[model samples]
Target: MADDNKAHTAISFHEAAVAAIEAQKERLVRQVTLLQSKRAYHLSAIRYYKGLITLARRLPPEVLTYIFQICIDLGYPRTPLNVSGVCSEWRKAALAPTLWSNIVVDPDSDERSLQRRIKFRLDRSGLAPLSISLSLSRSAVFMNVLAMLMQHTHRWSSLYLTAESSQEVDHFLGIFGRASFPLLSNIGLRLSFTGGEVPLGVDLQEPPLAFGDAPRLNRLSFHAIIPQSGLFYESLSLLKITSLILATTPRHQDVELLRLFTCLPLLQTLILKSKISIVDGDIGTIAEPVHLSWLRKLDITGEIEMLNLLPFIQTETLSHLHLRAVVPVSEEEQVQGSLADCLHSFIATQGHALEYFELHGFYLSAVHMSSYFTHLPNLVELQLHDSDISDEAIRLFSGPDACCPKLSKLDFRWCGQVTGKAMVSMVQNRLRGSHNLHSINEVTLIHCSFVQEADVLDLAALTICRLLGKPDDYCRGSTCCQNERYRQRLQLRQMFGVGGRVRKLTKNLIL
Candidate 1:
């Protein structure tokens, strides 16, 4: 009986211990479930606060739409597509009609895919005026795209088209000859060749009556194409174009060409690229020089002899003049006399009104330089590129008798003959305020062979100087000169004591 009592007590103790453990396990599971629920709640609160401080989220939908439009205008054609994927609010803003108005079709894209993308854009554009550019070679794809665009001609505000041949150009013009471009304000046409070798002496033919009915057109550009008098001129006159660009080898007589200018009484900017010369014989007396009273900017690319045309043009309000020489180096001497005479005449007539002048790849003698500076007393800026201007000519910018007293900026690029010494002297004299000359505010030197690092540093101390677009304040302690090879050679010579060792080391550097 005593042993039985002991066993029964032990059993009772074991049962009580097992019951306590079960209760503890149930409490722990409840606490763990509560902690997990609290963790998820904290994460949600953190995300909500972060979104409140986000800049893009805080901006109103209207402001977001405006920003998207600016991005598209700045050549980001994929902006709309990318922005829509960022968030729901951005997607709503990107849906604005005007955001998709600039439609530039990619010619290399698959035809079916392009059609779907173009359709999507057009549908989203609503009634917005379109700026369309179709730069495609002659192919079935071209015709198909043209057809698609024709359906929306009435909505075009600007159109740019390119073709590989004159016939293709004619065909494009013919398609639009009868169609109406009610909102078209600008047009650009380019006749590009695959090899870039257009027949040298071929004459341009008169284009068909195209864009004749574009009442709002104000700007026109022609690449490798020339405008001849006839239906094209008649249409152009009706439009009252304000800006014109012609890149061609003009074979017309001077008087006839002048007459063409007279037709456009509203011309404000003219960019002409021609190889100017007498087509057949002496130019007959121009009864009255072409008067372009509203002309403000004139850019001419041709041989220096082309300046002869300046004598026949009267632009009293002209403020900017750019002359680019495209002559062979061998022919420069032969044309020097003609260039001198033309420069004298041009500066005498129009130099007083000029504020900015640029000369490229021309050899200007000391005499011509004197005339230019003397006549252009109002000139404010001067740019010389690939020019053979002598140090003597540069000295004209200084001294007591220096002309162009108002000059404040000088830009020289690829000027092999100009030395850093002359440039430093000119800048010092100008900055000293001698003769009350205006201090030069800026100087730009790029690929100038003879400019040294010391000259650049000296100029930087006095005024703003730019070496290959590296500004003085931004490029201090760095090499600002283009004679790196020559500088390296000198360093190598000093290291080797100017003997066979130096020669061997400088074999790769300039002599």
Candidate 2:
């Protein structure tokens, strides 16, 4: 009886354990089903958001307009009209006034084909100031056809035209005389004579067209039309042109060209490129310098004789000068005397007003460069490309009373003679001794065979840190250095990821 009672108690305990296990399984199954339903709901929500994001209807109206404009700018077939076919919203954006203002017409194109296109663009442009470019060939008929759009000449802001023949030029200029461009501010004209019986010779007694008139024009670039033709000086005198570029014919007399430049008294920047002209009874002498008080930049590239005209130019406000030396093919046709002397005479009138100087494709010795810096005490930037730059020339900046004490930037490109030692000494010395006297900041030593990878490291850290683009005053570790934004930039330069790579790049840059 005792053994039977023990067996029965054991069986009862086993049955209770089985019941507890079954109850736990049911609870877990309900939880699994609940979690699966929540998972399905979350996945469905993700799909819904993805579909909405992919749909074009979700885009803002302004962004859609900009998108349509970019497609037009990229030259879509039929352009602004192409986007119109996409959707009603796109069509509305494409119809904006600015979208239809820029039209390029080929004067050589068949008028039959362009008539419809030009009419469409002009109608679409509405009353907006038109920016038109005419790639004119030797077809006056094209100009006559283009004249149909001349009624809207007052709406023109910018005009660019290329006429290869004399007849084309005559046609292009004829329109401006009849029509007016009150809103025009910029004009670029390229007129060359490749093939044609009509030469550039025109009656000197004939008066010029005032261009009816580009009163607001500030910049003008004319190639193959200067010195050879009086068109620029004759017509441009009325406009207050500040920037003028005259890439004249190769055979223009230097003295005659200089006389033409005197017409623009308000010129702030002048760029000239011309070749030696052969004229009967013409002397190679240049007279006194014409005063251009407002001119600040003069960049001249061509025959070295161009520099001879420097002494004849007096600019009280001139600050930047860049010259590229060229050797004339003829020994008789040479740059009169030394270029240094001519430049010295020009600088004397300006005093320390001339600050930025550059010489490319010019054979400059150490003494020549040193003399220039010595005379122009306020030089802040100097660039020498494909020049005869040596250690001695660069060392001028390292001395106690260096010539360019205010220099902040130096650029040397393909200067084979520039050794690493001289550059290293100048960089290190400028960093230590002349911190107070000079604002020396960055150096660009490119394609310099002597400047090794080691030479670039010293210059790299400063440049990398300068990526934040703080002012030069902030770079001196002054109170501005403590500003949170600048400090963060400094910290960023010191940090490991992209900053570290910028630092490492110094190694490859020197090579």
Candidate 3:
């Protein structure tokens, strides 16, 4: 009986222990499940917060829309439009009509792809006025793409076409003449006819008509094989052009070209690139000396002899002038006085009204500088490029009493003869006793090897002093002069000390 009891007790004890272990296992499972659920909930919360932050960082819809409009104005391939392609939201913003109003067809792109891109841009633009550009090579594919653009000419506000050959140009012009660019305001066409004469497929026996009845046409640029006849003038007369750039190879009727310019009553800016002889001949022959009173800017690249017409320029409105010598600098002694005299005479005549002047590949004597600056009261910016101004001439130009008070910016590059001492003296004199010295903001000295390191350091010091509004007291009295001398000595001593330190450091490195 005792043995049976012992067996029963052992059995009961084993069963209890097994039940306790099972309960512990169940509790562990519950705890693990709770931890997993909490972890999953925290992860979800983090993702939601991150999404909210990203949305907040995105540009406001209104600002995004404005940026898109600017991209359209600048034509496609603009940076803002590229940014708009970052994601779905941005892509939608970019596709808005206000953003894709202009389309530029790449000359090298496949015809099918170009057409698709153009069509996509147009569809996104809706009814907005479009600015279209066709960069065309001499290819059948280009011709086909151009024809497609012609179909939508009525919506164009600006058109630019570049052709590799005269035949392509002629074909483009033929298509352009037939189309109606009613809203076109600006047109730029660059044509190279080096291959051969432009074939007249469509008889232009009668001069081609204007592209359309574009009443607001204000700017036109033609760099091409301009017809010798006056047909181009007749075609251009339909629009009231304000700015015209005629960059072409010499034509037989260069005289007639000058006459053609008289038709543009409102023309304000004329950029003419022609041979010196041709320009001079045309100007000398003009009956009334063609008055362009409203003209403001003139950029001419030709020989100095052609500029004899400078005296006849009656434009009181002229403000900016850029003169570039097309030929090598004339070695003839006779031409020495030719350029300087002509420039001096022109400035003396119009210096009161001129503000900005840029001269490239021209030599200016000291006499010419003195003569020119005497009358230029309102001159603000002056740039001398590849000039032959000497150190003495530069000193005189920047003399203490030199009269260009309004001058703020001066760029002298490739002026080999100007020394560092002359430049430093000029700056010091100009800044002396002048409260407006700070107005002179930018001074560029490039390719001027004659300038020494000491002068460069002096210039930096002077510039810093001017910026800091230091005392304008000049070194005159012996005491002040001695003090200045002492300062220079101290500066030299410090430089030597630094050099020695650097040499020691370098020797240590070597060792």
Candidate 4:
């Protein structure tokens, strides 16, 4: 009887163990089902939110119509404002004329398509004045478009037309010969010829200056591959122009063109490109110098004799100057007092009046900057591109005395020698007396591999401290030194890491 009792006890214990295992399995299954249901609910909510955001971007026609008006006022093309791209309702609103007040026609576009676009713009603009740009590469197309648009010429505020040859130019001029575009203000032309020669049997001569009567015409640009003759100058002088940009292929007529600019009394902006010519020793020496009192901005490209022309500029009204592809005189020429000296002297004289200055592919020595910055009291912006300067040369522009009071923007792209430490020191020195060191709004250092992540963090920290008027204790700690390196590693891993997948790893610890 005792043996029987022991067997029954063993069976009872085994049965209890099996029942406990079954209970645990049931509990786990219920938990998994609950988790799955909760996950599905959250996912549905996320999808609903995303759909709402997409719906919100579908603006009403009234709002889109107002946006179209703003685009027109800001001089943006209407095609991009195509409300149809947003929604069906917006497309209808965008087709309105008050929206398509400006039309730009490409020369390569089919004639029928160009006419259709022009007519659509004109019809939509209603009685409002239109701004038209007709850019044509071929003569036949240019003539056809010009003739079609001639009837609406009075409504145009801006016109850009191209003539491929002298014959095409004659046809273009003939369209305006009988009727004047009384309201035309901005005009640009790209005139080229075939056979590498001016067309024969075509009167390339311009009509006598009728621009004196067209008081509204102000801005003009002509890019031609023709010789600069007396007629060209006379044709340009007809308008009382304020802004002019002239770019011509190399020719032997430099003297006549330079003489034309000397007579422009009201010209405020001038951009001239000197083309290289075999007949001319150098076009730079041939340009006549004029003291343009009304001129506020000047951009000169190509080889230019800076010395002879620098003295002629009176800096009182000059505000912006840009020099591109300027070749510095060699030691031989410098010994003879070439334009290099005059360029330095001019910078010293006009630096005070300049608000913005940019130099590209021009060599600047330390001595040249001493006088350059002394007069640039109001200098606010400086951009140096492809410059070759050492740390010592940059040191000259480091201290408080060297800093411009209004200087806020600096761009040193392709300036390899300027280390990150030197730049930070310069910033700290410049901001010594100032209560806020965050005055510098922008600093661009492209292709400057020398600037490390730590240096950038230091600059960022300094800027934040200066702006907030408090020190950053986080950056002051020893661990801060490793923060940038860790941050960079994290970024690299996020961008290009193994498995080509991203996952957020979180740990929950109970302390």
Q: Which candidate is the best by lDDT?
A: 1
Q: Each prediction's Cα RMSD? A: 10.0, 12.1, 11.7, 12.8
Predicted candidate 1 versus true structure: per-residue lDDT over 237-318, tens digit per residue? 6667889887765355556566667778799998888765522224425435788888989988876656677777788888
lDDT for each residue of candidate 3 in 1-511, tens digit (9 for 90 to 100): 9999999999999999999999998999899999999999999999777755686337776677777676655444675457665765566666667567667776557676876777777777788888877776656776666666677778889887776764565665665666666788888777655665543221222223545556567897766544443555666556678898877654434455555676666788988776534454344555455677788888777776656657556567788888877663522332366556767887887767778887766665656665677777777877765655677666544644666667766666556677878877777777774544324544555455586545545665555211111132111221321234433543564457743331111111100
Q: How far off is residue 208 in model 3, in Å?
A: 9.3
CA deviation > 4 Å runs, candidate 3: 1-99, 105-107, 135-154, 163-182, 196-208, 227-231, 234-238, 250-253, 273-288, 302-312, 326-335, 395-401, 432-439, 460-511
lDDT of 3 at 156: 88
Give the worst 10-residue stretch by lDDT in candidate 2. Answer: 465-474
* Each prediction's TM-score versus the true structure: 0.68, 0.67, 0.66, 0.67
Shift in Å, residue 18, candidate 3:
33
Q: Which ten residues in a row have the lowest lDDT in candidate 4?
A: 465-474
Number of the top TM-score candidate: 1
C-alpha lDDT of residue 68 in model 3: 66
Query: Which residue pairs in model 1 clash with each other?
Result: none
Q: How accurate is candidate 4 locally (lDDT)?
A: 0.59
